[model samples]
Target: MKKLVLSLFIVLFVFGTSLSQIRPVYAAENDFTFTVGSNGATVTDYKGTDLNVVIPAAYAGTTVTEIGRSAFDTYGTGKPKITSVVIPSSVKVIQTYGFRYTSLTSIDLPDSLLTIGSSAFENNPLTYVEFPDSVTMIGNYSFYMNNLTSIKLSENLKTINGGAFDTNHITKLVIPAGVTKVDSSSFYNNNLTSITVLGNATTFGTGVFAGNPGNLKIFGIANSPVYAYASSNGHTFVDGTVLFQAVVSAKSLLNSHLAGTGVGQVPANTYNDLSAAYHAAMIFVDGIGNATIASDLDNAAIPLTSAISAFNAEIIKAGNPAALVAAITAAQQAMTNHPQGVNVGQTSAANRSTLQNAITAAQQIFNQAGQYLQGELDVAVAQLEMAIDTFEDVIITAGNPTALGAAITAAQQALTDHPAGVNVGQASVGTRTALQTASNAAQQILDNAGNYTQDQLDAAVNQLNTAVQVFNAAVIQAGIPTALGAAISVAQQALTDHPEGTDVGQASAGTRTALQTASNSAQQILDNASNYTQNQLD
Candidate 1:
């Protein structure tokens, strides 16, 4: 009976019994019959002029098919009004601004409702809503500013359009598994405890779920898509993946560009988005503050405006846009206003006090790249140590000499390919001259070391490891890998162990002799790199 009544009433409402103006449905009231017989249907335009409107079920005999635009925008304002309304299920389409910004305190949407377009009930006083799986979408801001205590999405629903629930006052809600997304702020400032993302729902657009309920927390839906889509930035990401480090690191890389010089090797993490699109966003709250980064963000495939729009929508959906923006700006401003983009998101005394003390102990590395490029022997030694350490971790499992060799080559190139003569310290006439000789010798030895015996490889590895310990007495003496002299020892052993294998002794002897020379040369590069640090200390 209830279903039938709703169906027939809306049918007549569209065709009209209003003769003048039409209004939205009354709260929980469906007084007429279900079936509209079909008269040619009375003519009525549905702009905001109507007051206490009612549509008879069997209006002029035609079953109503559509509800017009702005059917109730500004309806019943300036009065304790909105006496009554009746809608028949025959009405299939509800247009934009329909029944929105009215004095409606409460209303029952019939189960027959299929579609409600954009801004339909924004600024209304509706306290509660129950979506029927039959309804496919609630357009952007359709229920924004409603005073609902809670909402429950219909299980059969496949799509809930963007901004469908921004700024509502719901305390709790359940998202049906069928929902592929929860557009920003669908529950913006409600009392929602948490949103239970269901089914295969994967993505949450930026700003989509932010500030929905102060207590609202996001949880992975069981069987939820591993990679969820970000509607704002449109990035498809795995759930629970950490991106703050990546975002901030990229910003730090961009920060170097601000100095307009000395921007070194790009961190691998910033290769993709350290561009115009990411920076152009007014969301400079995250360390992308300068105009240069903003221009870069503007030129990217995904514009900065859109990412923020998407995220803004999330904020709008949780609370009123005006309120959400203020809160977000406050939070963002507090973070970026600090120096170095360091501790970016850490606001408050607890963070300020604790972080200052802790960060003092942090060390800076790689910034001394120029010192290494200058062929400072210390820098070369350090580079070798780094390469070897990274290689051991790789070789222990993948025992591939080719891979280890490639790693070494990269380390060497860090110095050779450097544009400046000396990347590390103040160079005098002597060290500059020394640099060229050392570079040439080191390159030749590394190039020929492939034919080296196991003894040389082992010796090189040990030497590199010892070099990292700056205070190690062994490293301070004659330098590392160079001091090993593995080539000579291995060659002698080969001759003693394989007396008859002509190939073994011959190969060992040639390699050992070459290594002895190369070891002495490598020691010289180490001494050069260290000179810069010594100067700085002095």
Candidate 2:
């Protein structure tokens, strides 16, 4: 009997010890309310209202494994004063109402967290939070009513329950690849500009994106479930291939239309405006590097669209056949009505070269122009021809008159060397008469050279040079005696090769005098050759 009683006592003691491990509500001797469990402790309430709260990793020598329901709530009085929370890695679960109605603006949930219960973070003011990869489940209304601008979902996260992020301030959200299901209202009523899904979720609940802006872009692989979801729900689906093709096609069209001939013929300011518009559109096209359709549109679509529109308008105006014709004709008329004054002989060689180039360029443009512009091109060409003729005529009369003196000198030498009166050898009477007429004309101009104006002297020089050239030709044909012919031929050939008074800077006065002396001796031989016998002439 004594042995049996001791065994029962031992059994009761072991049972009591097992029961002690299950403390449903044991308030630990700490700043927080807690309950002891088999694994560790759970925080039940935050007694203090510190704006920045740091939950203890351990309570009463035991690691805290969870935050109990409503632990950080306002206790039905008002919102908690907590503005931020630092959760230790030891806590694996955040129960319902863990941080609800707190004034928390930021939180760093440790990577040890595995589950976040319903309404765990509802009504906070968090600006940025990164959920660690170990997290697998986000309960209903977990982050509802936050002020989150950026939130990173865990890569290992599998489920986001209803209203998980409802009524937040997120601008951009990227759903992780491991996500399999997103409950209804998961992203409801947020200021989300874009949502990119890296995962092909199997279950997308109704009203998953009910309250977002209409202009929000949904991004995913082209044939992925997320893309199908977006399409079925009438959301704008964006993919890489579509984005590249759309932007490139738009850019190409704009460039081709703007490359028309009329684009350059516009006024300088107008052309600059058109070019700038085209460049702006191209900038948007350049921004579309390896991006999905949603991403490309998010950054550059609107601006590019506006730029393209403006470009189209400008191109249309420029390409108007009637308008182009008017512009071209107006330019031609302007040149004709306000022709640049050419100062004739005073015009520099540079100016002449410029005029020549202008004509060539205009002809090129005319040749390349379509039929509509050719009429105006013809008019411009005619005006240019007139300008050229006027310029040439003035060029001759306006040149320096010093050339006339050289011409007269050459003529006098020719007469003295092979006088027509002395040279009666086999020359024709007509040839002799031509030489006399030429010499007299040259003499008359030389006599009055000083009295002539510079312009008149220039004309006289041209006339005298012609006369001298004629007389030289007649002498050659007349065949003077051998002695006179050789000298005369030398002088005549020199004058022909280097025309009288041309390039005078290179010819010395001594060279000219030598030539004249040869001619004078030649004439003396001719004057006496008639009296010599054939043997003496030979």
Q: Model 1 TM-score?
A: 0.33
What are the C-alpha RMSDs, in order, of all predicted structures?
35.2, 24.9
Quick one: best TM-score, which candidate?
Answer: 2
lDDT of each: 0.46, 0.66
Question: What lDDT does model 1 reach?
Answer: 0.46
Report the number of the highest-lDDT candidate.
2
Q: For residues 53-90, write the lDDT of model 1, one tens digit per residue.
A: 45443344576654556645555533223434555655
Write down the TM-score of every candidate.
Answer: 0.33, 0.40
User: Lowest-lDDT window of 10 residues in candidate 1?
Assistant: 470-479
Error of 2 at 285 (Å): 18
Candidate 2 residue lDDT tens string, 182-276:
99999888776577665544468888887877777776557777778888888887773343333444445544654544543333443455456
